[model samples]
Target: MTRTRFAPSPNGPLHLGHAYAAIVAHDLARARGGTFALRIEDIDGERSRPEYVAEFFADLAWLGLQWDGDPVFQSARLGSYVHPGERLKAMGLLYPCRCTRAEIAAAATLFGPDGPIYPGTCKHKQVDPEGAAWRLDVAAAVALSGPLEWVDEIAGSQRAMPEVFGDVVLLRKDLPASYHLAATLDDAADGVTLVTRGLDLFASSHVHRLLQALLDLPVPTWHHHALLVEPDGRKLAKRRGSPSLGDRRRGGEDGPALAAALRDGRLPAGISLSRSLHTGA
Candidate 1:
C-alpha cells in the first residue's frame, strides 16, 4: 500500500503553508486509497511546546485533514534516530567535529556554497578535544551513493551527486538527531513510498537520498509542491506570524473562502486558482 507522512515540527503555530501541505497529502492519500501518517518532528526540545503540538492537531482537524495509525513523535524516537548514525560511524563514514556556530558562519562567508556551508575545517583535520558533533564522511557518501535521481512531481526530475553536500551532520554534540537524520529514519520506518513537501526543502533532498543509500532504505518518490509565501513575497514562516487556519476559523471565514483567499494570490506561490478549484471537493 502507498504510505506518506505529513511531518511538522512543533516549534510554532500551524500556518496556511502547513494546511496547503497537509491538504495535499490528505488528498493524495485519498485519491490513491493509501495511508497517510502524521509525524511530530519535535526534536528541538528547547523550542517545541506541548501547546504547539496540541494546536497542530487542532489546526489539521479544522482544515479537514486526517491520518492513519498513531502519530509518531521524533522526540520519543531518539534511540532510533541514533542507530543509523552509529552504523555510519562504525563504518568510518562519520566523524566527530567540534565546530561552533560562529566558526561555521565564518567558513560560510569564505566559502561560496551558501550560508553555513561547513568548510570541512574539521573533516579529517584533527579530532575535537572533547565532545563533538558527528558528521558524515564525504568520502563515504560518494563511495556509497554515486549519484542521486529524484522526480519532483512539481519541478520535474532532478539529479545531484553526493559530493555537492560534502560532509553533513548526523548527530549534534548534544546527541540530538539533526533534521536530516530524524526525517530519514522516520520515512524509512513508516514505509513511505512517496514523499511530498514544500519546494523550499529542495536542497535537503540530496541529504535524504544519501541517507537512504547509506541505510539501504527504499528511495521513495518525491513531490515538491510550491511553497506558500507572504504578501511581501517572503517565504511564509511560523516565526513571521503568518495567518493560520485557526486564525481564519476564528474570523468566521469558511473553508471555501479560506481556500479562495489562498488561491486568489493573497499569498504568494500558493496553489493556483485553477488547481484549487480542481482540488476542492
Candidate 2:
C-alpha cells in the first residue's frame, strides 16, 4: 500500500508552505487509496511546544485534511534514533566532532549544499563524546554504498551525492539524532512509500537515499513539489512570519475553500511558487 506522511516540527505555526506540503501529501494518499500519516517532529529540544502540537491537529483538520492512524511523535522514539548513529560509529563511518559553526566557518574553504562543507577539521581528531556531535563520513559511506540512486516524481531519477553536504551530522550533541538521521529513520519506520515535500528539501533526499542504503532500509520514491514562496522567491517559512493557517481560520477564511483554491493554482496576491534548486535544505 502507498503511504505518505507530513512531518512538521512544532517550532511554530503552520505557514502556507506547510499547508501546501500537507495538502499535497494528504491528497496524494487519498487519491491513490493510500495512507496519509501525520508526524510531529517535536524533538527540537526546548524549542518544540506542546501547544503547537495541538495546533497542527486543528489546522490540518480545518484545511480538510485527515490523517491515517495516530500522529507519530519523534520525541517518543528517542531511543530508536540512537542506534543508527551507534551502529555507524561502530562501523567507523561516524566520528565525534567538537567544532562549532563559527569554528567551521573560520576553517572552511569549500562550499557545498549545506554551506561551507565541513572542512574535516575534526574528522581525525578524538573529540570527547559528551559535547560533540557525530558526523557521518560521507566519502566512506558512498564508497560502501557503491553508487546509490532514488526516484523523484517531479525531478525524476537522482544520483545520491550526499558528499555535497560533506560530513553531515548523524547525532547532535543535545539530541539523539540530527534532522538527517531522524527524518530518514522516521519515514522508513512510518512505512512511507512516497515522500512528498517541498522542493526546498529536495537536496535532503540525497542524504536520505545514502542512509537508506547504509542501514539497509527500504527506499521510497520522493515527490518534491514546488514551494509556495513570496513574489521575490523567498520560500514561505514560519521564521519569515508568513501568514499562518490558524490565523486564516481565526480570520473567518473558508478553510476548505482556501485549500481548493490552492489546489487550483490560485495563490494569494503576489505569492508564487519557487522553482529554484539552490534552496537551503
Q: Candidate 2, which ten residues in sequence have the lowest lDDT sum?
A: 272-281
Please write out the lDDT profile of model 2 over residues 1-281, one tens digit for every residue.
88999999999999888888999999999989999999999989898989988889999999999999999999999999878878888888999899999999989999976778899988888778887888999999999999888898876778878877899988999988999999999999999999998887788888999999989899999998988888778888788889989899899999899999889889999898767854423
Best by lDDT: 2
CA lDDT for candidate 1: 0.73
TM-score of each: 0.87, 0.97
Clashing pairs in 2: none
Candidate 1 TM-score, true structure as reference: 0.87
Q: Write the per-residue lDDT of candidate 1 for residues 159-258, one digit (tens) a residue.
A: 7544555677778877557877889778988899889887666667777887887788988888777666554546667787777667777677676555
